[model samples]
Target: MNKSRNWPVAVIVLLAIGLAGMAYQHFKFGEERKDFERRWNLTAAQLHNLSIVSDVPSDINFIPAKEGSGYVQLSGKLKSEIVRKLSQTEPASDGLQLDLSSDSFSIFSFDFRSTKSQITVALPEGLELGRFQLDLKSGGGSVRGVRAGQADLKTSSGRLVVSDVKAAQINLHSSSGKITAEQLEGTLTAATSSGGMSLTRISGDGTYTLSSGHLNGTGITGHVAIQTSSGDVTLSQFSGSGQIASSSGSITLSGQRSDSLNITARSGNVKLSKDDAFRGIYNLRTSSGSIHAPDSPGQTHDVIEVRTRSGNITIR
Candidate 1:
């Protein structure tokens, strides 16, 4: 009984001690944090090829440089002693090639101050790179208004925003935090393990995977392969052939697809909007749920196949 009665006192003493220690440390280190930052800049011959590989978790900005500047510039402030990166020209046949990475001695660190740093890369207007590759971690940011032959951007634990990226092949991957992309081209490959994904005006052949969050798309074109588990799948203005599989969440689509499509839902309702552009042979099946569709193929070679285990299928 005595020990139990004294537990609260012990906890209060420990908390007081911890707070006092923190106060002392703050008094000693407050000024050092202000001096932790330094400005840096690097220049390259051209802005045709670029690679950004960072693990320090900072917001990255891609902006237009001065016209005919004949150089790409990297300007940012180092926010911590361990947050140091350098850009160097890479070997290439034509155009400029630059790679930004951590300095040799400070390749990777767990310094918390580095997470809130910022980086900016400036390129000439109307610049299109041969390849744009960025592999970053957390503290999400935006990458916009650039064209590339191929683009691969990945992040986690923070919102990733992309816009006006025209690439031949594009892959956006994130494990957590929301992802928003728009006005993108190429054969897109987008996936999120546990967070929502939103796309607008995405065209060309594409594939999407959402493990346990909402997946939404608008103005999608070409062939697509989408799969979701325990997350809702919603699409609009979709065109061309595609396949979709939903494990346990709702699937809703409104499109102008007249090609072959195969869809399967384990336990989620599937809904297709009634449109004159949706002409196909309907073959809807379900195990223990209702289906509302045409009994015949509607005299079209295009097949729209749907199967569900215990969910309703709606086609009108």
Candidate 2:
């Protein structure tokens, strides 16, 4: 009888161990699911209407001109502090195209304002393909894939990114945070107070200005202008005549051929290098740094005038 009672107790103990093991596995599974949702949360505010374009036209994509006008506004103020999750999704692989090349249309206008929640905005494919506008006011937000004829972007303390844009005029200004653009065309103007600006594969005639941050560009043509109070300026393969100024940093121009080049620095060095000779009047000055430019080994015709307060000028 004692052995029989002991048997019952042993069975009870084994059952308890199994229950504990199952509970541990359940806890771990829940934790993994939580992490998976966190990284894939890409949410935004988007607008699409059928009335704007009764039938998604093949030749003419986007909204018709006479259809109408509308706006997208986001309040972003939440009532309760609930932990809501989000999941991100990407577009399908099969892309659409336009059959007719002669016709173009302006799709929509986006106006975004945010208060509390963070936002990421995505645009439709090749929209406007011509004329578009974006007006953003918020504590913080991000934008991607925007095209327009004329664009005006201003942010107080938020980050902005614009890519693959074809426009006649583009304007961007930000107080703090970084701005980067790639494959941008036409006349462009960008300004930032405490943030850096970087451009790559840019093709157009444009002007750029910056303060308290770095300004960098590659593969840029046309008239260019850059000024920085306390940052470095770097340009590569920059063609056309332009002016560059820096209050307290180095200025470097490489693989550059220009008609006229002017460089001024309060206390920094200036370096210019070119494989071929360029015809122009060069004015370079520095308060307490050296200026160096090696002349072409072959025949050349150019005028270089340099002045320094307490620095040396070296021409090779």
Candidate 3:
């Protein structure tokens, strides 16, 4: 009977030890979480360019500052160790470079599952940025209300959104991600692989190249070039010259006025729509498909050439 009583006591002791251990772990995790929840503020001299490199899931925002001042406001949850390391890094002469990757946490050996962290930056309005570039390996983000001389945004595999941007030169590249931009001005160059691209209300010379993705845009006023393979191309309300080429995908173009229109396709259909004010010489050709031209070739100064290997051509 005494031995039986001892067994009960031992079991009770073991239960208590397990409860204590669980409580300790819980408390430690809570403390670590609190550390990550803290916000960090940093100020620098007049910045002309900005570069950000992150390899984790993050959200970044660029807000136009109401007050005309050069300042960076960073707020988000990150590893305490990462915050510590960032505090030690020095900013470049022209801007700041942040590399927030798992490699950054290699120096710390604390055994804990890392939580997702995000860092957001807000810039002052009318700051006159010379260059704004972002290189993200994974995750998604957005940029808004940016006014710069040049901007370049690149991502490996995530959705990217940009709006209300006025730049002299804009370059966007994505390996496998969707890109959407609106109210963009100046010269724009966009390239994507296996991801769709959408541009709206653009007023500048633009060039878009895509492989296995769709390209769609509207309200364009300038020269434009589009090249795609296995993806469809569509444009509406275009008021300039355009050259489009595709393979295994259809092309649709509706223009207000165009001085020169050239389209080539392989195994895909080509469709064109124009206003009544359009007067151009039509040169339509197809191998294994029907051809529909708006008008016969004449002495008109403007030219619309359409060529297809195994697809139909329709013009109206």
Model 3 segments beyond 4 Å from truth? 1-45, 104-126, 296-299
| Residue pairs in clash, model 2 | none
Per-residue alpha-carbon lDDT of candidate 1 for residues 129-245, written as tens digits (9 for 90 to 100): 677777666566678865677888888667788888788899898888778999988899999888888999987999998888888989988899999887888988888778999
Q: What is the lDDT of candidate 2?
A: 0.53
Q: Model 2, 56-127: lDDT tens per residue?
A: 111111222232322221223221111231122222122111111112233421112222332222234334
User: Better model by TM-score, 1 or 3?
Assistant: 3
Q: After superposition, how far is residue 297 of candidate 2 from its true place, in Å?
A: 9.0
TM-score for candidate 3, please give it: 0.79
Which candidate comes out best when scored by TM-score?
A: 3
TM-score pick, better of 2 and 3: 3
